[model samples]
Target chain A: MEKKYEFLEHTADAKFRAYGKNLQEAFANAAIAMTNIMFDTEKIKPLLNRAVDIKGDDLKSLLVNFLSEFVYLLDAEGFILGRIASLTINKTSQGYRLAAIAKGDKYSDKYETMGDVKAVTYAEMEIREEDKGKCWVQVVVDI
Target chain B: MPKRTELLKELFEEVPSGVGKGGITKLTKEELLDLLEKGSEWSLENGYGTKADLEATEESGRMKQADSRQVSERALARGKPQLGTLGAGNHFLEIQRIDEIYDEEAAGVLGLEKGKITVMIHCGSRGLGHQIASDYIEKMEKKYGYSHLPDRELVNAPLDSELGQQYFKAMCAGMNYAFANRQMIVHWVRESFRKVMGTSEGMSQVYDVCHNIAKIENHKVDGEPKKLCVHRKGATRAFGPGHEEMPEKYRKIGQPVLIPGSMGTASYVLLGTRKAEELSFSSSAHGAGRALSRAAAIRQFRGEQVARELMAQGIEVKAASWKGIAEEAVPSYKDIDEVINTTVKSGIGKAVARLKPIGVVKG
Candidate 1:
């Protein structure tokens, strides 16, 4: 089976490339990759769900806002991401909007912590459908 | 020996550290706003630290320009829950023993005695500051698209413009949040000492400085005094002696510059020099800057093996997870002694004392 994401080299932060057959799947996998950086997402049981609704000026901006939402959720409310059940990106007259339903549990001792993703950056962010029906997203996050 | 281990455990527990660990203080949205305005002065009023602590902190623990009203609701929410936390990722609470004193006069003035223990806490505004930076960065990018810029991260507004002023105010608020956060952690460290060694007295604060932030300051350019907005990103203040803004007690010795090494390495204290202001805008290296990526660190070192080696050297390490240990291996960073030596050789900084970590609590 092909991997969902792979960690990349970064001098002082975490960088990764998430892959999927489509943009939505690629984004969902990106969330998982970022959460896995904080803790093992496989150990997170989907005890609750959160509806993430955010908008941005463009696709790249949308990507940063989308990933940063998870950082905010974990810090503001003790919620960690286990999986992304659904995600959709829409192009509006102005820019874009993203809606996602993320399933996860309240943080607990059962989950092992590696580190926290503090913020998402545009340093080396990319959104591309390189091959036909093949999508990949690259992100550099400040840890 | 037991006391050392107990101190680490107690600190690790009292001051929450690691991923998913919330702050110890639970503040309402209103209280969070107040904190953003007052900074460490808020900590003093709330019975956490002392007035002297505020005196020793960068910007006196409060940025005068900070207006909490400029802070966004999202930033407020993110900062409210984690008021006193040492967030994960290179943030740490270390108990170090001062081992070498290079400048006896400066060390004596700073009260850094050889072989005495000192605590060092490295962290920032947590989610609040992060959210603030992201929020404004997005705001800037939205107003002015990054297509023409060198990098999207460079999307910025003119400092005199409304959007830029708003960001400056919000950034100051976030800086205040970081100040209060460190003050609260200092209280917890004192409590840990009391719980473990039965005495919390005589733990006078040395000094605290802010890096990775911007400041509006007065500097001399070509022998003329000018006010400049100094952005010390990934650099710390090394203010020279007799700066009017510094605390009076050490006005003759200069401000203390803290440069932390990587885990399991020697950290240094250097006196800020007038040459620093003239040569480098009074800024010094923040830490032993990362030389290797974290992914490489993890692939090359196991957490257990790393901990075992540090333990073999008589250093006690306690962390939220083994992954944290592996990711912050000492080899992953450049040599601190070399960095400080370069700073000293540049005449912008003078070595005061060298500190070796005896215990660490990773957040």
Candidate 2:
């Protein structure tokens, strides 16, 4: 069993790593990890579902876009989150495309939100493959 | 600043429906691109702020190198609705009173007097700027794979490279967006005051400066004039008196450096010094650097408790999210006094006045 996600220490920003058996799982966990920057996922409920479609030129770009879309939704549209329900990635001639369904609801006073995530940064963002076909994605978010 | 409770209540509590989400003026793709290209000039043309406000801003609130073509659709979309908003996280708008004056002459020059009320705003270019940075970092990393880079975040492109130019251009545009965004917010703040208090008293931009930016400048190196790209990250440019970049009114004195403290701490206004040009490349620390991480702060303190403590100190706290208050607690930041002392001792900045918060609005 792989760890879903864990926090890492950074001097000025919030850093984290998400682990999974494949890239897609790692990507999904990464989204949840970013959401964790704002709300403690355990307390939030999936009441509003938002579909996300993003195109990027590479795997790294795809992951960044996937996470950034969630940040935008939360900031611009007030779509708070419990989790990402379904996420899929496909290769394209340009590079890679991602489709994800984020399940969450408008922020209410009932749930516990620790902080607001301002943006997902490229600071130390990476995707790596491990032994036995495991994948790990790392990101640092600016709060 | 007084008798404006009703308007303040509405402005602080919710975004007006006509102003779009977050109480910001929404923009179409074209308008946003134009804004990216023109910056504060676009805001001024649209009647958001006055010419004096732009003069107080860095580069007169426009960076001519900005190229909207380099900006992406996602970046545009993310920034479209956020214009004029006081963005979330540690960003805030605060009402303060001048507490102490260190240099009476400099304080007078800056229009600050003891017990005088002032409004200070802290924010950034929002999602568009972040997205631009992300997009460029990826492009730079791919072009020059970061095999030798010690930290992945420190990815760089050669200053003369095509990709580097593109990044610089996009970054300038983002800087412009931030300028216009802040200008519009200032406009709204004045309106809110006028609508409720029947006056826009004590609402003015003292000096607006960018802490994170790279500018091509000529500085003396080894007694020879050399062109350098000065990048000030987590730092403020402290141009001394007589510098060409200084606005006409400020040229005889020095650039006004606004250093804001964390909640419950004292903020300072410092004058850029000539010694800074010799010692620090005309740069100074932006604020008190973080003493703890957000998680550490959350673990150690509660937002409601912090709010109560601030209220006890006669500081009003209004927040879109209380958790934000906890993450940015006073304990989470370094001592502003020590930071200012270090800055002054280093000969980079000269203390002019100190400000204590009376009211704060955080998102």
Candidate 3:
């Protein structure tokens, strides 16, 4: 799927703008924008592979747990994910379960820390899929 | 947003708030200065806490470069007697339980075994910090002309300017005051728990951080590393592993980022990432941003109802007023999970554990 992305400044923080034909593609693009904030996306290579699974009751919570788990993989295991191989998400009795495979490099000095995001906040968050197969989400990253 | 009227009502009744609602103890300027210079150390010296508590605090609960003289008399006066007090509006002291552990290793380091009780304090320099910001922002607005600036709220003064330095010093002093305030309150909280449970040995500082103010930091912007006076009004620093600022024990695990939710919701403890510096100057979200305005919140919910609901959920709440409780109701704020997700996706912080509130005290 083809996608477009941009970074928008809201208040003291920034939010990623993603446009795609499906929810998965939009999420993938948003993830790319998030990583691109740290390093040049083109410079990262898929050198190692890993899988992640997250569960939440709602779409918002599912998205948060998914991203949080992904970042944990990179920080704890030194894995810089370059690609989302596959993702499967479904509702469960508890909330939602998401399983994903990602591939990327170990580390690179070429990247820089932009701002210290303390954690994801539950403020001014939204995810919408347009009628024309376009999807977008706005999240406020704590910095 | 929680109904502002309801929150105000509950807050006014239960929590000791306002400009001059003194706590059980008061402090003098000299004592306040000591708190500013020493941070939690002074509180410990005064028998508020022990040495082990300091290890869990960020920067050992003190910013070394803070110059107290830069603090104005006005700021000092505001801080005096305000030390050891919890200020109003979103600032709180919550007794929470480690409801879930995502990373056992990090959770172990934080001294969290499932069901363990922890006290989370959410506050800043109180009136002193607010006064400093008010004074400086006024000066900067006059000098820079707010309408002409890129962002009206981004009024700034040069880092080396007299006013700038003074604000920094005063802000640091306020930070110290907050640290001392939390420390003193931690002592009281222990006392309170001891009175109820007949034990005081288990409580300890997991982490303490500031959500507002600015600091001079070294970061690589572009390709060269440079010093910049980073202003984090509603943000918290999330320094990655191996940074000099981190405690030696936490260096390998990254700095602890405490994100407290509203009265009955779940809070989070996250860790910093090296990738954070590139994403946000090594900063992250402070809390669940207000989804509803205070006024709107007060109009929508009743403090008594909110309190009752929370109590039914097994959460004990104490507030200065019922209206205040309404203003801080869970529905008044955004979903915390979303905020955490953005940070993780942005590669700024990683979640270590989720905390569920058991008891709360609001100012």
Candidate 4:
């Protein structure tokens, strides 16, 4: 029930900082922060669960690919995200891989749609771990 | 005369201006690839616009280097259903009238007459292009690694390297998709006018050019001519007069650069200047950038208030939701008049005419 994310001031795009007790929570919060830019996450009823498995060159790549999956779903399949049901990040022999299930409903007129998020950029992106084991992920999206 | 509100509603419904997916048409993967390869020609062949429209388009709406094979399956999937959709964000469709003409000859050549209505559509490759950039960033980082990069987003492959060429080709295809997307919308705009105003005649395209694109073009560097891959990121290519790459009619006047403003503001049409070649690789600022974030805009103003204010000013605006209107409020952007004046004074472009929005449809 702690603070998950807060919006940051940006000139042209949407910027946010998400927090979690650990990396999994931070990554999950980051995904929610992104979807919140377009629609209200609370309003999205979890009508379906999507399986996500993706590999990246490193932790940063893993985080990006992890979040980008939701963009694809919204655009290609009209899936509106509610929350990250479960997530795990594993260190692979090559690099990092992410597996998770995203819970959301198919997009419909019931949702209050705003601007579209074009893509997630690595611009000013940060992943930090602080004392007491709190992890924070900062992201800037091209809307 | 048909009511402006009626036409605005028709355009809003016809253009699919929302975050929801699926455009006016759905394409199979193979058919989508062909559209990417052919660009606006595919749109025209399908009877979207006239032959004159293609001639007025930059590169005639096709990039020869584009190969759909270079595009990833993921990009294709996202792009296939979005060919004719007007996407959300700063993208828009406006019915504007020539409010001011600074250069008489230039305005005459480009067919800008006082009080004449013109349709301006501002958009890009949508989800397809977004995935292409994401895919290449992941692919390039694996090969080149981002340990030394000042910005991870700047991670790039060598221009002549295999990976670089592959991304270049794929990016070109994305540009093609945008060209075709706008062309199809042009068709819809014509159709909307015919349905509402009862005549689609004299609705001809003036010019269409890419806002952000990296191209291998011949330019002088340090006083010596060289072929450079000029990446005009967040800029519009403002090639000067006599540039052979421009349309035959435009070669005498230079390319027509279209700059769309935020909701309830004025857009501008500028002619390319020769000095731009020497100043900054023949590029000009694309639009009046955001002065405030979407969150701040929403927190400060409601969409209903924004719509009502514009309506009071005799400008009719339509969008999917009130939240959409607030995010694009006119006060949330920098002074567009100042931006246009800066471009003209900097000598990169010449002010041809200023356009005032009479009706707008936002995504």
lDDT of candidate 3 over B1-363, digit per residue (tens): 123233333333333332233454566667777778899999888998888878878768887767788776655655564566666567787777888888899888878788887778776666566555555665665565555655444667776888777677767777887777777777776666555556668676777776676777899989799988887866899999889977777888898998877788999999999999888999998898888765467578999999999988988777756766887889888899888888888899988999998777776
Candidates' lDDT values, in order?
0.88, 0.81, 0.70, 0.89
Candidate 3 deviant stretches above 4 angstroms: A1-143, B1-19, B141-147, B150-153
DockQ of 2: 0.38
Off by over 4 Å in 1: none
lDDT tens string, model 2, B14-39?
32211114444657788989999889
Identify the CAPRI category of the predicted complex in candidate 1. high
Better of 1 and 2 by TM-score: 1
Tell me each candidate's TM-score.
0.98, 0.89, 0.67, 0.98
Model 4 CA deviation exceeding 4 Å by range: none
Chain A TM-score from candidate 4: 0.97
- Residue-pair clashes, model 1: 1
lDDT of 1 at A142: 90
lDDT tens digits, residue span A48-117, model 4? 9999998877777778788888898888888989999999989989899888999999988888787788
Each model's fraction of native contacts = 0.83, 0.29, 0.00, 0.73
Clashing pairs in 4: none
lDDT (tens digit, per residue) of candidate 4 on B18-123 = 4765787867777899989999998988888889999999999999999899999989988877779999888899999898989899888888999899999998
- When sorted by lDDT, best at the front, the candidate numbers are 4, 1, 2, 3
Off by over 4 Å in 2: A1-3, A19-23, A40-62, A73-81, A88-99, A105-114, A122-136, B1-21
lDDT of 3 by residue, A102-123 (tens): 7777754443322122234334
